[model samples]
Target: MTSPTTRSRTAAACMAVLLAGLAIGAAPAALAGTEDDAGLEQTVEAGEEVVTEDAVVTDGHVDVGPRFLDDEWTMLARDDREVPSVWRDPARTVLHLGDAAVLPAPDGPDYEFLGVEPGTPLHVVPQTQTPDVVWLGWNTQDPRVVDSVEQGATLRLDGLDGPGELFVFLQEGVTGPPNVLWDSGEPLPQELWMEVNTHVHANWVFTEPGIYRLDVTTLADLADGTQAEDESTLVFAVGQDTDPAQALAAVAADTTSDTASDTADEQTADGAASSDASPAADPATEVTDAPEAGAPSSDSGGSAMLVWGAALAAVVLLLVVVGRVLRARRARDAADQATGDAS
Candidate 1:
């Protein structure tokens, strides 16, 4: 017959084995959670500072967006071209458009809205990142901005001055349709609504290469039952040959130019009345469609898949361990019963 001492020792051994198996199974899931928390903390800490120095960013990631500095609304560029991204004064930053930015315009009726001949060269800063070309986007993710703003803000393209037309558009997914945000061919002061804490990237297409200046404005309702508004000029040198100094010195474009152009077109029309007409209303301003805010970053989906995969693997291992433990217990029980009967 099995002694009480032997049975107690076997029970202890089984408990140890089960505990070790559980620890092994749970390790991966615990590690994944720790990593996710660290990533989120890093993002928040990275945006806590605003760098006041002038910078020229030709490559890597950068965001042109709005922020609150000392309770005042301001437009700035969040430069991530290097480690520890910081907010920069828009007037002091130059976004260089290099030769790597050039691409042949895609052939499709949908792209014709770009007002470019299909297959012609277009300088594009894509929504998705390219290694050598600068990845430019906008965000309202500054901690200060998020705390001050109510729900969101309105981004207005007040004016644009450039050698070629500019177009901004967003694609839903890899194969989704394009949603145009701002078109230089359209009227001035076009607005786009942006939810607070949103980080968004869009394709910036330039029809030709040269210096371009965009007059950008942000307006928002503050949490304190007040309104805040600010405007700044965003300058770009849109070619290797274009001088960054020229863009820095560029002034805000005359917002009245669009109205002037329309008036001139009316005068040249045959049999058209010479009466003075107001500039065409911007249809975009009335509807103000907001882009997909807080879209998952490229790595977010992959990270989620990895976490789920690890959890699944752990569960499978645990089930296998539990099954083995049950079978071993059953065998021990039968052996002990047979020995007792023999005794």
Candidate 2:
């Protein structure tokens, strides 16, 4: 026979072993569940990526382009936690730092890095000597449509502001208001854009395929520490040609359709909301549907004419009674006078 203490110890050892096995067996499941939960949370967050809607200005003079691809992009005022808003058409396209990005410039392809903002002297260009490092935070920026480029097709780049010299400086060579083709090194008018200024609108068409470096620089008046000085360079790129123009057009069309759809949706939503908001009618209360637009309503005019005719009849009867009373009095007075004269 085993001693009581020994038996108790044995039982305790077995329980401990069982518990340890259970813990080891459950560990993977618990960890996997945790990972799944975390993944679900990530999916939810990613799915909720907030794309800003079209910004409409009451002033009527607001930039109109996919906020991401807009050459007339504006920098967010410093001190705001929200990153400066940028928009792109091809929503699926990804942008990388030092990758072809557009910026404010004085001449050539310019990037508007900063405008009138507090603390940063109004219109002053921040020093960015390193052209490659100057980047717009496009970590979340994706084109509205993805993979919309085709081989051998050209894209038109219209710059906001004015007609001035436009240059596309690549790591390979320099192409400007006079565009140089990447393949044969020959130039085409399709690639060339007229020189424009800050107020003039200019457009350029790029028809060659392959990865190309984009460097745009332009000068703007900046009151720098007392004297006006500084030029800003804007850089961006066009990637492997895969029907970029068509894709851009498609994206634009999609955006337009989306806008119209949104408007329709909003109208629908408004109508629904208005209908829903209407006060519930009491079962005892009656509703009369109004007539259609521009059509005469239910012979109301005829009813009014009938009422006017009745009023006119009453007036004519009153007038006839007064005239008869006056005539009777006049005839009686004349006979009485003649009788007195005869007596």
- Return the lDDT, model 2, position 94: 20
Tens-digit lDDT track for model 2 on 42-161?
Answer: 100111123433221111111111111233322110111124433322232222222222222221222122121112111110111113322121111112111121111112232211
lDDT of each: 0.71, 0.29
lDDT of 1 at 171: 59
Q: Candidate 1 — which pairs collide?
A: none
TM-score of each: 0.60, 0.29
Q: How close is candidate 1 to the true structure, as a TM-score?
A: 0.60
Estimate, for each residue in 31-77, the C-alpha lDDT of model 1 and write its tens digit: 42353222112243424679877677788878777776776788888
Judge candidate 1 against the unseen true structure and give its global Cα lDDT, from 0 to 1.
0.71
- Ten-residue segment with the worst summed lDDT in candidate 2? 58-67
